[model samples]
Target: MRSAYSVETVRAAERELMARLPEGALMQRAASGLAAACAELLGRVYGSRVVLLVGSGDNGGDALYAGARLARRGAGVTALLLAPERTHPGGLAALRAAGGSAREAAGGALDGRAAEDGAVAAGVAELIRRADLVVDGIVGIGGSGGLRPAAVPLAVLARASDAVVVAVDLPSGVEADSGEVRGEAVRADATVTFGTHKPGLLIDPAREYAGATRLVDIGLRPHLPPTADLEALQHADVAALLPSPAAESDKYRRGVVGVAAGSARYPGAAVLAVSGALHGGAGAVRYVGPAGDAVIARFPETLVSAGPPSKAGRVQAWVVGPGVGDDAGVVDEVLASDVPVLVDADGLRLADRAAVRARTAPTLLTPHAGEAAALLGTSREEVEAARLPAVRELAARYGATALLKGSTTLVAGPDGGPVRVNPTGTPWLATAGSGDVLSGLAGSLLAGGLDALDAASVAAYLHGLAGRVAAGEGAPVGASEVAATVARVWRDVVGGGWAAPSAGY
Candidate 1:
C-alpha cells in the first residue's frame, strides 16, 4: 500500500528528523536526490543546458544546490532567481562556486535597476527555450493556491518549451493538502517527491498537474506516524483481500447478492447490473425488479422475483438504484434490510437521508460528481474540483461509506480512517453503465463477508483492472465487456500474473 500524509504531518515529521541530523545534512540529502533525478531526465548531464526557476525558501535552495551539482559534472547550469534578495545564501554561493551562472529573472529587480520589459521577456523565454531540462522550484509543499504573478510567466514559458519539465517536490501552484488547483499551475512531465507521499500527489485535480511521481528516500519514514491520511492499494495488497472458497464451500455458503434495479422503461440497467453481480464473488444473484424477463433471458441462472423486496428471498447483501426510476418504495425496503446495502444511480437520489442515517447495517453510497453535487446541494464543478472534501463530507453526513467515482476512485468510510484512493483505472471507464456494474461488484464483495470499506476498495481495484483489460491498447469497450472481463482479472490477480495498463495519474 502507498500511504500519503497531510502537509502538516509531513512537516512535523521532517522537523523531527532534521533536529536529529546535522544542520546542513537534510538539505544536502534532498539536493543530492533532486540532482540525480534531474540528471537521469537529461539522459546525459555533461554539456546539457539546465535551467532552474528559483524562488525564496528551501524549495529554491533545493534547485540551486542541485544545479550546482550538475555544474560540477560539466553541465551548463543557470539559476533564474525570482527573488534575488531572499534567495538562500548558501545555495546561491554553492552554485557560483561550481562555475554555474546566476541571473535575476526578467521583470525582476536587477542590482537596484529594472531592465526593459521586452528585452527581459525575450531573455527569459530564450533561456527556457534553449534549455534541455527545466526544474520547477518556484513553490514547495507549504505553498498554496496557484503560482504568484511574478512566477506565472516562467511557468508559462517552461510549458511552451521542448525541455522536459521536472518539479522539485511537487508541481508549483497546486494545493499540497487538498489537491485543488484553483488558479494556474505548472504542468510537469515528472515530479520527484521526497520521503512519504503527499495527499495532493494521489488525489486530483492536483494529481493531474503532477506527472509521474518518483519517491526519493530522504529517510523520513521512522519519524512518520503509522496511520496515513490516504492510502492506495497495490497489486499484492489487493490480492490478499480477494475472497476464495474452501473445499467445503457451497453456493449458499459462498453468499447471495440481491439486486433491486431497473424500470419498465429501462430494463437494460437491470441486466447490466445482474451481469456484473453474477461474475462477482456472490454464488447466486437474486434479482427483484420489473426487468425480470430481460435478466432471465441474459443470465438464466439469476433468481428473479416480483413486487416488494421483502419477498426477494434470503440474500446476504443488496444492491439498489441502478435504473429504478421513481421507485423510492423498493429503495426504502432494501435500506430497511439487516444486510449491507450499496446505493447508486437513481437510488442516490431516492434514498432518504434520515433512513440511511438510521440504518445500523453497513450502507455504501456510490455517486459520481453530478450525483454527489445534487446530494450536497452544490455544483458538479465544485465537487469535481475538490473530490476529497466532497467524499468525506458525504460519508460523514449520511453516516455511510461513500465511494466517489472518477478518474481517481476514492472510498471514504463513515468513521474516518485513511481514505482509499484507487490507483488503477483508465479514462475509458467514463462510459455509460459503468457505475451500475461497480455497484453490483461491490455489493457481491459485501455479501462475501468483506466490510464496507474493504468491499468498496477491492471492488474499485478489480473494476479498474477489468476496465483496462476490456479496453486493451486504449480501444473503446461497453459495460458488458467490462463485466465479462472481471473473472479474467480476478484469476490473474489471484495467480499474481497481472500487468496494469497505461493511465494518467
Candidate 2:
C-alpha cells in the first residue's frame, strides 16, 4: 500500500532521526538523493546551467548542498539567495568550496544586485531565460502560506520558461497535510519528497501542483508512527485481499447481496446496481423494490422479489437508497435488516441517522459532497473546503464508516483512525448512476467478507478502472458501460492476461 503520513508525523519522525544521527547527516542524505534526481533530469550535469531559488530554511539548505554536489561534477550552478542574511551557512560554504557561485537575485531581477523599482534587469531576466533548469526551494514544512513576494516573480518566470522546474520536498504554498492551496504555489515538473509521502502529494488541488512525485528514504523508518493519515492500495495488496472461492462452497455459502434500489421514475438504477453487484463477486443478487421487473428484464440472473430488504431472501448484505425516491418504507426496511448495509444516492438522503447508528452490523454510507452536506445539515461548499475533517465528523456523528466521494474519495471509521483516500477514478466518472453502481459493488464486496473500508475503496478503484477502460478512444461513457467493464477491470487486477494502463502512475 502507498501510505502517506501527515506533516506533523513526518516532522516528528525527522526530529527523532536527526537526534540519532550526526549533525547535518539528515540534510546530506536528502541533498544527495535530490542531486541524483536532478542529474537525471539534466541528462548530464557536466554542461547544464542550474539555478537555485534559495529560501531561508532546510529546503534552501537542500538546494545549496545539491548545488555543491553538481558543481563538483563540472555543472555551472548558481544560488539565487532570497533571504541572504538567513541562508544556511554550512550549505553556502559547501557550494563555494565546490566551485559554485552564490549570487543575489537583484531584489526584483535575476542578477546579483538589488534592482530599481518597476524595471526588469535585462541581464538577470536573460540569465534565467537561458538556464537549463530551475530548482524551487522557496519553502518547506515550516512555511505557513503562499510564496513570499520575493519568490513569486521567480516562479512565474520559471513557469513561463522552457526550463524544467523541480520542487524540493513539496510545491510551496500547499497545505502538506490537507492538500489545500491557500495561494500562489509552485507548479513543478517533478517533486522529490523526503522521508515519506505527504497527503498533498497524493490528493488534488495540491496534487495538481506536484507534477510527478518521488520519495527519498533517509532512514527515518524507525521513527515513523504505526498509523498514517492516508493510504493507496497497490497491486500485490489488492491481489492478497481478493476473495477466492472454496472447492466445497455453494452459492449460499459464497454470500448473497440484496439491492434495494430504483423506482417507477428511474428504473435503470436497478439494472445498473445489479450489474455492478454481479461483477463484484456476489454469489447471487436479490433485487428488492418496485424496479424488480426492470432488473429482471435486463438481467435474468438476478433473483427478483417485490418486497422490502427484510424479506429479500436472506441476503448477506443490503445495498439501500440509490433511486428509491420518496419511499419511506423501503428505507425503513433496509435499516431494519441485520446484515451489513451500504447506503447511497437518494437513500443517503432518506436514511435516518439515528437508525443507522443503532445497527450492530457494519454500516457504510457513500455520499458525494451534496448528499453529505444534506446529511450533516451543512453546505456542500463546507464539506468540500475541509473534506477530511467533514468525513471524520460524519463518521463520528453517525457511528458508521463514512465514504465521502469526490476527486479524492475518503473512507473514515467511527472510531477515528487514519482515513483512506482512493487514488483512482477519473473526471469521466461524473456520469449518471455511478454512485448507485458503486453502492451495489461495495455491498457485494461486503457480502464477500471484506471489511467496510476495504469494500468501499476496492469497489471505488475497480469502478474507476472500468470507467477508464469504457472511456477508451475518448468516447463518452454511460454508467451501464462502466458496470459492463468491471469484469475486465477485475481480471486486470487479478493478473489474468490484462495489462496495467500505461498512462497511470
Candidate 3:
C-alpha cells in the first residue's frame, strides 16, 4: 500500500532529523536527490543551461545547492535571487564556489542592477525563458497560501516558457495537508518531495499541479508515525489479501453472496449487480427481489427467489438496494439478516441509521454523494467540499464502514483507521447501474472473507479498471458492459498485462 502522511507528521519527522544530524546534513541529502532528478530531466547535466528561481526560504536553499552540484558537473547554472538579503548564505556560497553566477537585471535591462526588486523580476523572467530548465523554489511547507508578489511573475514566465519546470519540495501555493489550491501555484513537470509522501501529492487539486512526484529518503524513520491518514493498495498487497480455496473446499465453503436489488421498474440493475457478484469470487449468488425473473433470464446460474432477504437461502454476505423502490419492509428484512450487509442507493434512504448501528454483524454503507446527502440531511455540495470529513462522520454516526463514491472514492471504517482512496476509475463510470455493480462486487468480496473496508476498496478498484477497459477507444459504456468486463480487468491486475493507469485521474 502507498501511505500518505499529513503535513504535521512530515514536519515532526523533519524536526527529529534536524536535532540528530549535523546542521546541514538533511538539506544536503535533499539537494543531492534534487540534483540527480534534474540531471535525468536534462538528459545530460554537462553544457545544460539551468536557472534557479531563488526565494527566501529553505526551498530556495535546496535549489541553490542542487545548482552547485550541476555546476561541478559542467552545467552552466545561474541564480535569480528574489530576496538577495534573505537568501540562504551556505547555499549561495556553495553555488558561487562551484562557478555559478548570480545576475540582477538592470532597470528593465539584462545587464546589472536597476533597484533590487525590479532587477530580480526581470532577471528571473529572462533567465526562465532562455534556460533549458527552471527550478521552482519559491515556497515550501512553511509557506502560507499563494505566491508572494515577487514570485508571481516568475511563475508566470516559467509556465509560459519552453523550459521544463521542476519544483523542490512541493509546487508552491498548494495546501500541504488537503491538496486544495489556495491561489496561484506553479505547475511542475516533476517534483522531488522529501522524506515521505504528503497527502497533497497523492490527492487531487494539488496533485494536478504536482505533475510526477519522486520521494527522497532523508532517513527520518524513527520519527515517522505508526499510521497514515490515507493509502492506496498495490497488486502485491491485493494478491496477499485475496482468498483462495483450500483442498477440501466446496461451493458452500467458498462462501455465498445474497443480493437484494432491483424492482420491476429497473430490472437491468439486478442483472448488472448479479453479473458483478459472479466475477467477484463468490462460489454462488442468491437473488431475492421483484426482479428475480429478469435476473434468472439474464444469468441462469444465479439462484432466484421471489420472497424477502430473510427467506433467501443461507449466504455469507448480503448486498441490499441497487434499484429497490420505497419498500421499508424489504429494507428491514435485509438489515435484520445475520450475515454482513452492504447498503446502497435507494436502500440508503430506507435504512434506519440507529437500527443499522445496533446490528452485531459488520455492515458496509456505499453511497454516492446524492445518496449520502440524503442520509446525512445535508446537500451534495457540502459533502463534496469536505469529502474526507464527511465520509468519516458518516462512518462514525452509523457505526459501519462508509464508502463514499465519486471521482476519488473514499472508504472509512468505524474505528477511525486510515481511509482508502481508490486510485483507479475513470469518468466513463458515471453511466447508469455502475453503483449497482459496485455494490455486488463489494458484497462478493465480503463473502470471500475480507473485511468491509478491504472489500469496498478492492471492489472499487476493479470496478473502475473495468470501466476504463470497457470504455476502450473512448466510446461510452453502459453498467452491464462494465460488469461483464470485470474478469478481464481482474486478470490484468493480477498479472497478464495491466499497465498502471497514468498517475493523475
Candidate 4:
C-alpha cells in the first residue's frame, strides 16, 4: 500500500530524524538525491544550463546544494536568490566554490534602485527562457495560502519557459496537507520529495501540479507513525481484498447482490449495473426495479422481480439509485432493509438524511461533485476545490462511507481515519453511466463480505483499471465496454501479482 502523511506529521518525523543525524548530514542526503534526480532528468549533466529559484527556507538550501553538485559535474548553474538577506549562507558559499553563480532576484532589495527592477526582471526571465532545467524552491510545506506576490512572476516565468521544471520536496504554494492550490503555484514536470509522500502529492488539484512524483528515502520512515493520513491501494493490495470462492462454495454460499436501479425512462442503467454486479465476485445477481424486463433480456441469469426490494428475495447487500429518476419510494424501501446498502445517483437526492444517519447497517454513499454539492447545500465548484474536507463532512453527516468520484476518487469513512485515494484511472472513464457500474461493483463487494471502506476503495481501483484497459490507445470507450472489461482486469490483477503504481495518475 502507498501511504501519505499530513504536513504536521511529516514535519515531526523530520525533526526526530534530524536529532539523530549530524548537523548537515540530512540536508546532504536530500541534496544528493535531488541532484541525482535532476541529472537523470537532464540525461547528461555536462554543458547544460540550469537555473535555481532560491527562496529563504530549507527548500532553497536544498536547491542551492543540488545546483552546486550539478555545477561540479560541468553544468552551467545559476541561482536567483529571491531573499538575498535570508538565503542559506553555507549553500551559497558551496555553490560559489563549485564555480556556480548567484544573482539577487528582481524586485528584492538591490541598493534601493527602483530603475533596476525592470532590467533585473528581464534578465531573470531571459535566464529561465534559455535554461535546460529549472528548480523551484520558492516555498516549502510550512508555507501556506499560495505564492507571495514577489514570487508569483517567477512561477509564471518558469511555466512559460520550455525548461523541465523540477520542484524541491513539493511544488511551491500548494497546500501540503489538503492538496489545495489556492492561487498561483509552481507547476513542475516532476517533483522529488524527501522522506515520504505528502498528502498533497497524492490528492487532486495539487496532484495535477506535481506531475510525476519520486520519493527519496532519508531515514524518516522509522520515526513516522504506523498510520498515515491517506492511503492508496496498489495492485497487490486490491488483489488481496478480492473475494475468491472455495471448493465447497455454492452459488448461495458465495453471495448475492441486489441491484435496485433504472426506470422505464432509463432501462440501460439497470442492464449496466447488473453487468457490473455479475462480474463483481458475486455468485448471483438479484435485480429489483421497474426495468426488470430490460435487465432479464440483457442477462438471463439475473433474478429479476418487478416489485419492491423487500420482495426481491434475500440479498446480502443492495445497490440503490442509478437511473431510478424521481422514485423516492424504492430508495426508501431499499434503505429500510437490514443489509448493507450503497446509495448513488438519483437515490442520493431522494434518500432521507435521517434515514441514512439512523441505519445500523453499513452504508456507502457515492456522489459526483454536483451531486455532493447538492447533498451538502454548496456549489459544485466548492466541493471540487476542497474535496478532502467535503468528503469527510459528507461521511460524518450521513454516518456512512462516502465515495466522492472524479478524476481522483476519494473514499472517506464516517469516523476519522485514513482517506483512501484511488491512484488508477483514465480521463476517459468520465462517460455516462460509468458511476452506475461503480455503484453496482461496490455493492457486490459489500455482499461478498468486505467492509464499507474496503468495498468502496477496491471497487474504485478495479473500475479504474478496467477503464484504462478499455480505453487503450486513447480511443473513446463506452460505459458498456468499461463494464465488460472489468473481469479481464480482475484476472490481470489477481494473476499478474504485484505491480508498483506509475508516476502520475
Candidate 5:
C-alpha cells in the first residue's frame, strides 16, 4: 500500500531529521536526487538547455543547486531569480561557480519589484520557450491559494513550451495539504518530492497538477509516524486483505449476506445487488424484499424471502437500500440488528441519522456525491470538489464508516483515521445499479469478517477493477456486466495469474 502524510506531519518529520544532520545536508541530499531525476527525464542532459525559475524559499535553493549539478554535467543551465537578493545565497554561488548563468528578473527588492510590469517579462518568456527543461521552484509547501502575479506568465509559458516542467516539491499555487487549486497553478509534467508524499501529491486538483511524483528519500522515514494521513491500496495489499476459505470451512462457516433491496418497480436493482454478493466470497445470499421473485429468477441459488429482514433467516451481515425507496421501516429494522449493515441508494435517504449513530454494530454508509451532498446540506458540486473533507465529515457525523463514491472513491471510519483512496476505477463503471452492486459486495465482505473500512475499500477496489475488465478497450459497459467480472477481478487481486501494479502512489 502507498501512504501519504499531511503537510504538518511531513514538516515535523523533516525538522526532526534536519536537527540530526549538518547544516545544508538535507538540502544537498534533496538537490542531488532532484538533479538525478532531471537527468533521467532528459536522457541526454549533455548540452541541454535547462531553466530554473528560482523564487525566495528553500524550494528555489533546491532548484538552483540542481541547476548547478546539471551545469557540471555539461548541461547549459540558467537561473531566473525572481528575488535576486532573497534567493539562497549559497545555492546561487554554487551554480555560478559551476558555469551556470544567473539573471535577475526583479529590478529591486521583491516587495517593490516592478519585474512583471517591465521588460523582464519578455526575457522570462523567451528563456522558458527555448529551454530543454523548466524547473519550477516558485513556491513550496507553505505557499497556498495560487501563484503570485509575478509567476503567472512564466507558468503559462512553461506549460505551453516543449520543455519538461519538473516542480520542486510541489507545483506552485496549490494547497499542499487540501489539494485545492483556488487560482492558477503550475501544471508540472512531473514533481520531485523529498522525504514523504504530501497529501496534495496524492489527492485530486493538486494531484492532477502534479503529473507524476518521484520520491527522493533523505532519511525522513524514521521520524514519520507508523500510520499515515491517507493510504492507497496496491494489489499486494488487497491480496493480503482478501479472505481465504479454510479447508474445513462449510458454507455456513464462510458467511451469509442478507440483501434487503429492490421493490415492485425496480426489481433489476435487487438482481444486480444479489449478483455482486454471489461472487463476493459469501456462502449464501438471503434476499428479503418485494423483488424476491425477480432475484430468484436471475440467480436461482439465492435464498428468497417474501417477508421482512427479521424472517430472512440468520445472516452474518445485511445490505440495505438500493431501490427500496421510502422503505424507512426496513432500514430501521436492519439498523437495530447487531450484525453489520451497509446502507446505500434509497436507504441513504430513508434511514434515520440517530439510529445509524446509535447502532453498536459496524455501519457502512455508501453515498454518491448527490446523496452525500444531501446528507451534508450542501450541493453535489461542493462535495465533488472537496471530497476528502466531505468523506471525513460524513464518517464523523454518521458515526459509521463512510464510502464517498466519485471519480475517486474514499473510505473513512468513525475514528477519523487515514482515508483510503481507491486507485482502481473506470469511468465506464458510472452506470445504473453500480452502487447497488458495490453495496452487496461490501456487505458480503463484512459478513466474511472484514471491518467496515476494509470491506468498503476492498469492495471499491474490486468493483473498479471489474468495471475495467468488463469495459475492455474503452467501451461502455452496463452495471450487470461490471458485476459479472467481480469474481474475475477478485481472483486477479488474489494472485490469479493476471495482476498489474496498482495505479498510484
Candidate 6:
C-alpha cells in the first residue's frame, strides 16, 4: 500500500530527521536525489539548457542546489530568481562557483520598472521557451492559497514553452493538504517529491496538476508514524481483502447479495446491477424490483421477486436505488432490514436522512458531487472543491460510510479514520449505468464480509480497472461491457488459475 502524509506530518518527520543528522545533510540528500531525477529526465544533462524557477523558500533552495549539481555536470543551467534578494546564499554561491548564471526574473527590467516589466520579461519567456527543462520551485508545501501575480506569469510562460517542467517537492500554488488549486498553479510534466508523498500529490486537482510523481527517499520513513493521513491499496493489499470459496464451500456459505433497483422505464438498470453482482464474488443474487423479466432475460441465474425486499429471500447485504425513480418504499424496506445496505442514485434521494442514521446495521452511501451537495445542503461546486471534507461530512451526517465518486474517489467512515483515496478511474466511467454496476459490486463485497470502507475501495479499484479494459485504446464502452470485464479483472487480482471466460455475458 502507498501512504500519503499531510504537510504537517511531513514537516514533523523532516524535523526529527534533520535534528539527528548534521547541518545541511538532509538538504544534500534531497538535492542529490532531485538532481539524479532531473538528469534521468534530461537523458543527457551535458549542454542541456536548464532553467530553475527560484522562489523564496526551501523548495527554491532545493532547485538551486540541484541546478548547481547539473552545472557541475556540464549543463548550461540558469536560475531565474523570483526573489533575487531572498535567494539561498549557499546555493547561489555554489551555482556561481560551478560556472552557472543567475538573473532576476521579476526585478529591474524583468519587474515593472521601465516598460512595464520590460524587455527582460520577454527575454525570460524566450529562455523558458528554448530550455530543455524547467524546474518549478516557485512555492513549497508550506505555501498556501495560490500563485502571486508575479509568479503567475512565470507559470504561464513555462506552460507556454515546450520544456519538460519538473516540480520540486509539491507543485507550486496547490494546497499540499487539501489538493485544491484556488487560483494560478504550476502544471508540471513531472514532480519529484522528497521524503514522503504529500496528500496533495496523491489526491485530485493537485494530482492532476502533477502530471507524473516520483518520490525520493531521504531516510524520513523511520521518523514518520505508522499510520498515515491517507492510504491507497495496491494489488497485494486488495488481494488479502478479496473473498474466496473453499473446497467445502456451498453457494449459501459463500454470500448472497440482494439488489433493489430499476423501474418500468429503466429496466436496464436492474439488468446492469445484477450483471455486476453475479461477477462480484457473491454466491447468489436476489433481485427485488419491477424489472424481474428484464433482469431474468439478461441473466437467468438471478433470483427475482416482484414483492418488496423484506420478502426477497435472505441477503447478506442489500443494494438499493439505481433507477428506482421516486420509489421511496423499497429504500425504506432495505434500511429496515438487518443486513448491510448500499444506497445510491434515486435511493440517495428517497431514503430518509433520519432513517439512514438510525439504522442498526452498517450503511454505505455512494454519491456523486451533485448528489452529495443535495445531501449536505450545499452547492455542487462546494462539494467538488472540498471533496475530502465533503465525504467526511457526509459520513458523519448519515452515520454511515460515504464514498464520494469523482475524478478522485474518496471513502470515509463515520469512525473518523484516515480516508482511503482511490487512485484509479477513467472519465469514461461516467456512463448511464456505470454507477449501478459499482453499487452492485460494492454490495457484493459487503455481502462477502468486507466492511463498508473495504467494499467501497475495492469496488472502486476493480470498477476503474474494468472501465479501462472496456474502454481499451480510447474507445467509448458500454456499461454492460464494464460489468462483463469485472470477472476478468477479479481473476487477474486474485490469480486463482482462473482465466477470463469468453462472452458469458
What is residue 443's positional error in candidate 5, in angstroms? 1.1
Best by TM-score: 4
lDDT preference between candidates 5 and 6, better one: 5
Q: lDDT value for candidate 3? A: 0.85
Best by lDDT: 4
Candidate 1, RMSD to the unseen true structure? 2.1
lDDT agreement with native, every candidate: 0.90, 0.84, 0.85, 0.91, 0.89, 0.88
Cα lDDT of model 3 by residue, 329-407, tens digit: 7888989988899999888989887889999899999998888888788999778755777788899989999999987
Per-residue lDDT of 433 in model 2: 87
Candidate 6's residue-wise lDDT over 118-227, tens digit each?
23344788889999999998899998888877788888888999899999988899989888888889999999998888888877778889888888999999999998
**Pairs of residues clashing in candidate 2:** 106-113, 321-347
lDDT of candidate 4 over 6-73, digit per residue (tens): 88998899899999999988999999999999999999999999999999999999999999999999
Clashing pairs in 1: none
Better of 4 and 6 by TM-score: 4
Please identify which of the two predictions, 1 or 4, would achieve the higher TM-score against the true structure.
4
Query: Which of candidates 1 and 6 reaches a greater TM-score?
Result: 1
Q: Write the per-residue lDDT of candidate 5 for residues 385-477, one digit (tens) a residue.
A: 678889999999989999999888889999999999887888898899998899999999999989999999999999999998999999999
Candidate 3 regions with alpha-carbon error over 4 angstroms? 102-120, 148-150, 374-379, 472-475, 495-505
- TM-score for each candidate, following the candidate numbering: 0.97, 0.93, 0.89, 0.97, 0.94, 0.96
Q: Which stretches of candidate 1 lie over 4 Å from their true place?
A: 108-122, 500-505
Evaluate candidate 2 by giving its C-alpha RMSD to the native, one decimal.
2.9
Candidate 3 lowest-lDDT run of ten: 105-114
Which residue pairs show backbone clashes in model 3? none
Worst-scoring 10-residue span by lDDT in model 4? 112-121
